[model samples]
Every structure is written in structure tokens, then in C-alpha cells.
Target: MYQLYYSPRNASAAVHWLLHDLNVPYELIRVDRKQQQQKSAEYLKLNPSGRIPTLLIDDQPLSETAAILITLCERHPEQAKMPALVSPDRSKFWQWMMYLTNTLQNELMVYFYPHTTDSNGIEAIKQAQVVRLAEILTLIDRELSHHTYLVGDTLTACDFFLFLLGYWCLALPQPLTEYPNLTRFMRLMAKHPSITAVNDIEQFDLDCDIFTFID
Candidate 1:
């Protein structure tokens, strides 16, 4: 069985969704963020970066959410979590995956940890980042309006990655519901059995939707 070191609502969330979606037998180990367990000596040995959602594949550590997702998909093409490696679809998948992580997810990191990026006027810097992220959201909302899925008609790991990022966007000033296409996408994804399985384990209050705005 695979093992994932995660903290609630951290970047590890995407990996958690992937494991559930594929029905892969795995262990979820919560490295408490509040307690600073992620930086503990043992965990640091596994992930030199001391980040959450490190996957142990046969006792080997794989850090970075994007890398782990792509590796899992490549290793288990039989699971159909991603496209065939040499196929054009795989090329498109890489495009979305890299864009999601490097572009979108990076924005979120700055938004979440502005202190690390800006030495002064953290709130001002954060608000600026939020404004920038809003533009990114609007762009994705527009693209999502035309495509049922991010890459293709069928769901892929890219969608799962974006879904978790959307989950993090619950704090946005405009609210994700304002973007009709994004709201629709999140609502539909929320109903998936795999997503619900992770929700149950994570203790998220499903009674209230993550992005708000009903139907």
C-alpha cells in the first residue's frame, strides 16, 4: 500500500483525492501543521523540503503534489487517472498540470504566505495578489465555460488538482460562486463518489458547500 503524509486542507489534498478516485489502498498520515509536526526530524528526513503530502511508493519518497500525481498516473495507466504517456492528450495534460501548479498554485502560496514573499505591508501585498488571482480565476472560468473538463471530456488528475485549488479559494472576496462556470464545475465535482469519500475522511462540513451558492 502507498503512504501519504498530509495535513488537513494542505497541498496534499490533491493526492488524497487521486488515491480515493483510483480506489488505491493507501495510508494517510496527518503531520499536524499547528503542532509543527511537518518540520519534525523524522518527517524532514522523508521530505527534505518538509512539505505535506509526501507519497511513499515502496518506501521511497515523492514530494511535490504535481510530481506525485503525474508519477502515479504514469505508473498506473491501467488506473486511467491520466492519459497515455506518449499520446497528444498527455501533452495537453502536462500543459494544464504545469500551468495549474506553477501559475495558479503559486499565486495561492503567495496569497497564503505573503510574509515570506513581501517583507513589508503584508496586507497590501496580499490584496494585490488577490486581485491578480481574481484575474486568473476569471480566465479559468471563461475556459471552463466551453470545456466540460479542463483537458478533455473525461476527468483527469488535472481536474482533481484544480478542484482542490478551488477548495482553497473559498476565502476569495468575490466568492467562487460569482463565476458561474466555476461554480457549476465545483458543484458537479462535489458530487463525485471519490470526492465525497475524501470529504468524509477530512471532516469538511459538506452540509455547507465549499464554494457556496446552491444550484
Candidate 2:
């Protein structure tokens, strides 16, 4: 059995959704971020970064959403939640995954915590960052304009990655309605059975009130 250390409304939702999609037996161990439980020595031993969504598989621990998603896809190829390495679409598949994990996610973190790093010319830098994020969102909107999912027609890890990003964006005062395709994509993603399972998890409701954007 796999043990997943997670907080309800965080990026952990990605892994939670993936596990539900796989229907793989697993244990959900709640890590309360507000309580700073992730910083505990015992938890630190599992993930030095003290982040949520740490997966313990037979005592071996794994961290990071991209790595976890890839591992799950590989471990259970029968699930077909991700594209095959040799598949021609694999490059684009992995590109979108990394883009979400690295670029989109990093930018959003900056938006939320502008003081963490030197803002330099504070006002100017914030404006530039917002512009960059808007451009990225526009690109995603264009991509989804023609296809139902990030990769093509089917639900893949890429979709989950973007879905979580959209979820975060939705919580902000800024509405994603500006990006019509993205809004539609999120609505479509909300209907996935796997996603529904994640919402049904005990902690999801309390933690992900932002997801109510779908309703």
C-alpha cells in the first residue's frame, strides 16, 4: 500500500486525483500546513523540502508532483494516465507537464508571496510578472481552444497539472473568465470521474472551497 502525505487544497490534490484515477490502494496521511506539521523532524526525514503530497511506497518516499505523476504512470502503465515514453506525442506531453510544474506554478508562488525574494523595483516588477502570467494563461487558452484536453482528446497528467493551476488561479480575485478556453477546459476537467473522486475525499471540501468556481 502507498502512504500519501497531503493537505487537502494544495498541490497534493494533483496526486490525490491521480491516485483516485489509478484506483490503486493507498493511505491518505493528512499533513496540516497551517500547523506547520510538514516542518516536523519526522516529516522532514521523508521530504527535506517539507512539502505536501509525499508518497511512501513500501517505505521508500517520493516527493514533487511531476516525479510523483510520472512514477504513478510508470508503475501502473495499465492505467494509461500518461503517454508512453516512446510515443510521438510524448515530448509535447512532458513539455506541458514541466511547464505547469515549473513555470506556471513558480510564477503563481511569486504572485502570492512577492516579499519572499527581493522585489527589486517592486511595482514595475510586479506588473511585469502579472503580464507574463497573463501571456501564459492566454497561451493555455489558445491550446484548449481546439482540443478538449491539454494533450488531445483524452485526460492525461498534463490536464491534471493545468487543472490544478487553474484551480489556484480561480481562487484569486482575478477571474479566469478572461480566458474563455481555460474556463471551458476547467469546466470539462471538473466532470472527470477521477476528479470527482478527489472531491469526495474527506479533506477536499474543507480545503478546496476555491474549486466551487466550477459550480
The model with the greatest lDDT is 1
Error of 1 at 213 (Å): 4.4
Question: Which pairs clash (backbone N, Cα, C closer than 3 Å) in model 1?
Answer: none
How much is 109 displaced in model 2, in angstroms? 0.7
lDDT by residue for model 1 over 113-210, one digit each (tens)? 87755467888878999899999899889878888888777899999899888878877776787788887888778777877787856665445664
lDDT of each: 0.84, 0.81
- TM-score of decoy 1: 0.92
RMSD of every candidate to native, in Å, equals 1.9, 3.0
What TM-score does prediction 2 earn?
Answer: 0.88
Q: Model 1, residue 201: what's the lDDT?
A: 64
Reference-based TM-score of each model: 0.92, 0.88
lDDT of 2 by residue, 150-204 (tens): 8887788778878888977865545788898888787777777888766766343
lDDT for model 2: 0.81
